[model samples]
Target: MVLYKTPNLKTILLNVFQDGILPYDIEDVLSLLVQKHYLMNKEQFLNYYKNDINQFWRDVASLGFKRDEKKATAESNDINDLKEYPEDNDNDFNIDDFFDSDEFKKRSDAEDIDNDAFKRNVSLIKDYQGINNSNERKNEKLNDICKINQRLVEKIAGKYEKMVRGTCLNIDDLIAFGNHGLLKAIDKFVPDMGYQFSTYATWWIRQSITRGIADESRVIRLPVHLHEKIMKIKNEERQYENEFGAIDASELCKNINMSDDEYWRFKSIAYQFDQITHLETIVGTEGDTELQDLLPITITVGSKSVPPDYMLTPEELFEKKELHDELENTLECLTSREAEVIKLRFAINKPDTMTLEEVGEIFHVTRERIRQIEAKALRKLRHPSKSKKLKDFIKG
Candidate 1:
């Protein structure tokens, strides 16, 4: 008789990676088995999975291992199928703009996806309820309609591109807003209204673009209703000025049917719209000072208060440069991958430092592996030859 015993989680993990199999390939699969009580003991796991690594990976691939391939395929198909379109009656349709709007180059790269791998991903995603027929059909229909009318959205969005330039928005942002509006139009559209769908969609698309600008282009976002009121007030003022010259605040308020308090309140809010200037804007006549430099900072020297001096003295700046160069030279001692890991871990040339798990995900490795790499890199950096200059710089 053969002896049988239940093995712990650690034993299973060790067995899974013992064959040089990536932890990513089997970690989730093992977790699922444990969580679902699929395997009662080590003997069963070894009998079913440990002996057949190929079958184990197929099971993982079926569970949507890393990426949801179905969604990517659907998106790629939507972009590809855009070439099949109805007759264009409008002469204003520029093929270049249409291609630019849809980002054809980016979408075409999706065609190069490995068929075998895609099939594996799709098979797994299907089993997980991640992509189903009903949802897929609905998405296909939505994408088709969006692509068909994409030219209309692009045309409307193009009109606002220059207007929103230098604000927190660009042409691409406007096009996204237009696409959102197109989707909304598709949902609420009544075909029996005896109006062209393009005409109806144009209103919604323009509304969406304007709303996006109002919501996003400002440092402080204002309510959409407030923005509408502001626009109404401005239109009234423009019309009133054209008919009768130079209307004061009280007169303007009466003309717009707003009370004095409301007019003053609106004016106060509107003033901020004009005050939007980037901190990077040059201020001094010599163009050496940014607007941020004018911001006040208090420094205490003895008992007296003084503004903090941001300008570095020649010697101090040279020392800082020397220290930075030395650090770079020390980092060069490490292998390229190790240097990149250290740089990313410490937020060097990056917006923020990443956690070991996040770094691992980027490199397609496990968190423990990333930890090992980080520790190894740190050990090298801590060596006397590497540490001595860094320590002196810190002390100085």
Candidate 2:
């Protein structure tokens, strides 16, 4: 429901020129004019302006404005000038030699003046009251321009403040953030870029306001980049649902070009911000059991019960005993080393089975040697004589 209005081109130009001089490069100003007013880029503007550049300059000229013919020619010949200063290939060439050359010496000598002494002499000139008065007038004009700009910034910020109502941040804070963005936009804006300043500044303003909300409104703060990504994912989800019938996780991942790990990680963080059940909320069918009552009570380490769920039931216990007796009789058929290895590997008494490496360390043999013996013992157990002893148990 928010309505955003873009400032007119004349308003932008008036604000820029109120200081009575162009603050940006001449090329930049021309480029902006070509884009915003003439609907052309720099190249096209140059072609069209070539014939009337002098007249154009005269129309825009103000105090201290003067054309630099030499500078303009140098700019036009920039590529050719680069060719004149080609890199020296010789590693032994002394760079200092160029600085000591006649051309460099002539340039330095022509510009050699004691800057401090010149300033001191100028300060001693009491007859130049007119110059001091002119400088004071310039300062006053600059102050007036600053006041006008300040008022404009406030007006723009006020509009944005209303848009962010009901957010955790107060109106004043929103305005302050918006004003900061406005100042930055003003500093970097190129009016001739075929766009209104309002359009550019609005983006900055909205970004600042939204960032403030993300930072202040969350119980657990997330990085700005993560928050922005979460918002983008939610928006994409809504768009996908509207276009397609249902959401497919793999398809969404492909569309966003995100890995499964990254998508799930962001989703988990976003879910933390959603509303959760309170401990006092009723959870059971009887309506008497609260959520907190259903939670397991924490027990101290010494008071913790040895989990009985893993213990064998009566029938299972009886079956296990019969199997153990059969295994013991069958193990007797193996060699002494093989019997020991089988018992240790299966953890007949110990809490956990021993690895081949552990059995090797105990018997003073390599793990490969232990493995070979175990394999040989298993082959022997599968013999007709030994197999017949356990055939009934296996069939049952």
Q: TM-score for all predictions?
A: 0.34, 0.30
Model 1 steric clash pairs = 62-124
How much is 205 displaced in model 2, in angstroms?
Answer: 2.1
Model 1 lDDT tens row, 14-54? 35444433343234444645555545544566575546544
Tens digit of per-residue lDDT, candidate 2, span 66-138: 3322221111111111111212221222222222222221221111223333222222221221235587665
lDDT of 1 at 287: 88
Estimate the overall C-alpha local distance difference test score of candidate 1: 0.57
Q: Which candidate is the best by TM-score?
A: 1
| Root-mean-square deviation per candidate | 27.8, 24.2
